[model samples]
Target: MKYEKAQEILPQDLINKIQEFMDGGYLYIPKAETNKRSWGDSTGIKKELNNRNNNIYKDFESGMKVDELSNKYYLVENSIRRILREHKKSNK
Candidate 1:
């Protein structure tokens, strides 16, 4: 989200109308419903995580210790265990 000046884009009358209720503050305008995207749709974070999780699962299958995976991935031991569980569950 970038801050756009009303004076730069909006007409003076519209700006005045908005100012009647709000003197000077930030206003958030959301995208249209049809234009909305699911979480991680625009960014590749979800895809990256899926790939990483797959790698972790593969490493675990290849005899990597959970603690070693935790250290390599910088995740908690429990989190690595949970990821392994999730992968196993999904594979089934």
Candidate 2:
């Protein structure tokens, strides 16, 4: 099942964290809460994405280049690039 828009479904604290990342030019969500109902039957894809995004943040923070980081994680390179670009723009 498709995930709902973040603001609509995420808890307040999670939403705040997500907003903080977004404000800093990252697009990420936290690991799904176990008690909360998920958008779909827990396929685990969203959680996996969250983990991958977290890894991306860690790598980025360590001074890894987007292309190298994306290659290492097997993720969509454009998404990482966009997140970095947006983050820079938002901070300005």
Candidate 3:
């Protein structure tokens, strides 16, 4: 989000009221609760990571070691382990 001048957007009375509480600081106006999007939902990052984790599990099942998967995916060993564990739990 970009900063818009209060004078340009807010009514004079509203600006004055805001200034009374905060002299010249930034004010954040959040999006409505109904309009909120979860992290990565709009960017498709969640989908990408899901695909990646699925591939990782496939490779693990096909006899690829955790360390090898980590190196191939450029993730840490612990992250690979967590992914495998989560996949196992999901399968169960």
Candidate 4:
């Protein structure tokens, strides 16, 4: 799937809603069904983390070890390893 930046894909209405949340002193965006899915949830940190993990796994499968990739990407090797471990356990 091709990823588009949030500023490009988010409609004006959604942008307004996000601004409202921010203005109201809310650091986290509230989950709301703007279309078929919750906009806030779809663009959240959890989704970003999952995407990073998938990319890491792909690199690992292509002959890059966890430590090497983690060093190159400036990510914590142990954290990436744990994420891979949990992902494997969940798929079992």
Candidate 5:
């Protein structure tokens, strides 16, 4: 986001109509609902996290201990357990 002056974009008549309700304060307009993107859609972090969780679940299935996974991923034991649980739930 960038702040754009109304005069630069909106027509004078439209600005006047808007001014009737608001004197000079800034107004925010949001993007259309259908055009909105979910968090991490642009950065690919969501995908990366999903892949990592999948690997963790697979490792656990292959006899890897929760403590070992916690150390390998630098996460708390509870977080590793939670990720495993989430994977199991999603598979169903």
Candidate 6:
């Protein structure tokens, strides 16, 4: 999200009313529900995590130890285990 000058875009009356209520403040305007994206939709983080988890599964199938995977992926052992468990559950 970017800060846009309300004075430049909004009607003068609306801006005046807003200024009357709060001077020199931030106003949060949310997108319409129809325009909203789900989490990670715009950033590609979801795709990246999926790719990492798939690689984790492949590494485990190739006999990678949990601790080794944790070290290689920079994740904790428990996180690696959880990823493996999630993969298993999803496969079923």
State which candidate has the highest TM-score. 5
lDDT of 3 at 8: 95
Clashes of each: 0, 1, 0, 0, 0, 0
Question: Which parts of model 5 have CA positions greater than 4 angstroms off?
Answer: none
3 or 5: which has the higher TM-score?
A: 5
What's each prediction's TM-score? 0.75, 0.44, 0.85, 0.49, 0.89, 0.79
> Model 3 misses residue 19 by how many Å?
1.9
- Write candidate 6's Cα lDDT for 1-92 as tens digits: 78999988999999989999998999999999999999998999999999999999999999999999999999999999999999999999
Pairs of residues clashing in candidate 6: none
Alpha-carbon local distance difference test for all models: 0.95, 0.72, 0.96, 0.73, 0.95, 0.96
Ranking by TM-score: 5, 3, 6, 1, 4, 2
lDDT of 4 by residue, 27-70 (tens): 44344665456444767977887788777777877899888988
* Candidate 3, lDDT over the whole model: 0.96
* Model 1 regions more than 4 Å off: none
Worst 10 residues of 3 by lDDT: 1-10
Can you write out model 5's per-residue Cα lDDT over 4-46, one digit (the tens) per residue? 9999999999999999999899899999999899999989999
The predictions' CA RMSDs to the true structure, in order, are 2.2, 17.2, 1.5, 10.8, 1.2, 2.0
Query: Candidate 1 residues 1-92, lDDT tens each?
Result: 89999999999999999999999999998999999998887898989999999999999999999999999999999999999999999999
lDDT of 2 at 4: 67
